[model samples]
Target: MSHYWDNLSARTNGQHTSEEFESAAYRLVVEQVIYYADRHSRATYWLIEGFERDFREALAPLGITLDVNRQLRYVYAKPQYAKAGTASVAQTLLALVLRALYDEGARLGQFTDDGEVVCDLVELEEKYRLMTGRELPGKGEFSELMRTMKRWGIAKKSDESLVQRGDSDQTLPYAVIIRPAIADILGEMALLRLAQWKELDHMPRIEDTESEDDHEVTE
Candidate 1:
């Protein structure tokens, strides 16, 4: 056996010979929603590309499926045994809002050739208000939510400190990069759930919503 296989075998106590690659693949998928060939570091992309088959085979045993979007140049994982409350109420709502904006942008042909939907905090807030018939969360809360979204690889902000200002001024536009990963995170079922939530007699108060920091992911 090769040195890599030998190390892997030793690590798995002879139960598996490819555990090393599998473990690495599992970590990469869980850490980020998408691994973009164009945006990710060369080494990171190469690692995923090189072990794509092993990655899928390993994850299959754990009920996690790997999805590689070649055209979009990214890879995402779908867990068969999905756990509830992986995202906070605020984060979930924000994702729905972003998904709504993305769909609207696509319908209006506003997306760039590369498939990115660029929007600002102001537009997002306006769309939220229109959709939910409620004011968007305060600057502090919205900023924190944006940080969580960015951490999860669903969105990116042009100005790191823009959200920290805590000003509700809609005129001050801060550019946000709405990544395609949003679609994967908030799939069809999630959207349906959001729609049902919106139809509730009383929507949950934004201030009372829990932060993403309080969430836990489990299989």
Candidate 2:
């Protein structure tokens, strides 16, 4: 692995140093995902794509799988196993809901130039109720949850400063831009489990909700 890292560190001749690889790997693991469209991570995204094999080999021993979505221009790590309580029910349910909403938007051809779905919280709330028969968490809790979503590359608030102080400001952003990475996180199996949430009244364990190749419920 060090050999590969050393090779990568030298790939750019004098333009980059070993620390470049170290920094990129650190972000890849710690941030969990990177997208070419993200201004902050664009260079790291390219570096990972350029030396994907090296990154994969290095991450493998840690039981992490690198999923590079070339068409979508993003990459994320999947842990082979999840620790107990890695995700609260709120987090897991919300992620599954976002994945479903992304699919729904794709089916309707509603996408931005970046292939992301944009919708206000009203829609998200309705969908959450339709799938889980429960209201969303409180505003502060929802806000905190979105921070995790952003960190994982799943979704994000379109306007970070657009929060409204009252319910009348529904048109204000409370808007979420669902990234393509959401599909990679939850996949079709999450949709199937939505039916279970309705019919069986069961909140799936993280182990049960994972798509076949991924098992981590995320933090």
Candidate 2 vs. true structure, TM-score? 0.79
Using alpha carbons, what is the TM-score of model 1? 0.71
Task: lDDT for model 2, please.
Answer: 0.79
In candidate 1, which residue ranges exceed 4 Å CA deviation? 1-26, 37-40, 159-173, 201-219
Which consecutive 10 residues in model 2 have the weakest lDDT in total?
210-219
lDDT of each: 0.66, 0.79
Cα deviation of 89, candidate 2, in Å: 2.0
Alpha-carbon shift of residue 92 in model 2 (angstroms): 1.9
Name model 2 segments beyond 4 Å from true.
1-4, 81-85, 160-170, 199-219
Shift of residue 140 alpha carbon in model 1, Å: 1.9
